[model samples]
Target: MNDQQNLMIKVVLDNWYSSVKRSDAIFNSLTDEQLLQEAAPGRNRGAYLMGHLTAVHDAMLPLLGLGESLHPELLEPYVKNADSKTDNHTPQQLRQFWSEVNEAVASKFNALTTDEWLQKHTSVSAEDFAKEPHRNRLNVLLSRFGHLEYHRGQVAFLKEKTD
Candidate 1:
């Protein structure tokens, strides 16, 4: 890979790593009850958010060619009700799940080539926005990161409320 591509990859990977670390640290502070508590109406609980974040990593990993797609059905759940669980698990279980997801995300990211990073992949179609011919892989990754960050904020807010 060229120096510029390598630099970009490093920047993206480093930023992602930092974000994940910060998120995990924040999540670690919450109690099991707090993680499962619903912060607002029609919103997912912390457990659901954790599941959803991992699910996104699971889904995106395959698209990046790091692993096989295990659960296509999980795509919808990740986007919609990832954090809205009917039953709750212990804090240990939640942390284990988060670890698995983080590993998967890191593994997938590590496997990417510069060309693959620049390649395009189709993302979810939104009727509300103007129809686009296609969405790139970079855009897909960015959108997932943005979504995670938004939910991370919500998780923090919920944490504060419960504290």
Candidate 2:
């Protein structure tokens, strides 16, 4: 990759790191009971949002060709079903899972070269990737960044309900 491309990758990674840090802060601020409570009366609980983010991030491992997910059991409850329909984990378990998955992902991400980031993700067939080079590993990170921020906002609002 050229210097410009390397710089762009660094910028995106930095932003993603910052967002994850902010999310951790928001999540740590809430009590376990607070996490079980909904941010709004009829909305998903804070615990569900946390678990959902964890499961989604875990899935990205295989999607990005990093490795298999460490928490495959999370897929059915957290990803396949709505929060209302799925069984929620304890806040402690969710917190541990969240930390473990993100740490594993970050380690994998840090080891990747700029060229690797630009390589086609595992989900794309070679023919499709050749036609659409934009469907790369870095693009997955970008999309997941947006996903994390969206749920982070919802979880952050839980602080208000607790107060």
Candidate 3:
């Protein structure tokens, strides 16, 4: 990796961490009652969004060649089904899951080299990645960052209920 490439990777990773930090702040601020409340009428509850984001981030471990998912069970409830169709664990349990999954993923992320981030993630075939190199691990991280931010906004809305 050249200096420019390394710099670019640092910038992206910095932004990724910033997004995570913001979400973390919002999640930490919410009370259990607030989390169980819907962010908006007819929309998902804060607890559902928390679980969904954690499940998605958990899946990223294997996708990024980091490790197996820490919470595969979560995928069935949080990702494969709608919020209304699924029953969530208590807010405390969901918070534990979020912290565990994110810490594990973050450790794996910190261990990767700049070149590793540019390499193709596990989902893509070598031939396809060769044709479209942009489908790399860093790209996946960027997409997931955006996904986190979207749901974080929904969860943040629940703070109004508390106040």
- lDDT winner between 2 and 3, please give it: 2
Ranking of predictions according to TM-score: 2, 3, 1
**Candidate that beats the other on lDDT, 1 or 3, i.e. the better one:** 3
Q: Which stretches of candidate 3 lie over 4 Å from their true place?
A: 85-87, 161-163
Q: How far is candidate 3 from the true structure (C-alpha RMSD, Å)?
A: 1.6
lDDT of 2 by residue, 23-122 (tens): 9999899998888888678888888898899999999999999999999999888788878734467899999999999999999999999999999999
lDDT of 3 at 145: 88
Sorting all predicted structures by lDDT, with the top scorer first, yields 2, 3, 1
Deviation in angstroms for 68 in model 1?
Answer: 2.2
lDDT at 88 for candidate 2? 60
Clash count for each candidate, listed in order shown: 5, 0, 0
The sequence of per-residue lDDT tens digits that candidate 3 reaches over residues 1-163 is 8999989989998988898899989988888888888889989988889899999999999998888999999998889988872455988999999999989988998899999999999999999999999999999999998899888877878785543
Taken over the whole model, the C-alpha lDDT of each candidate is: 0.70, 0.91, 0.89
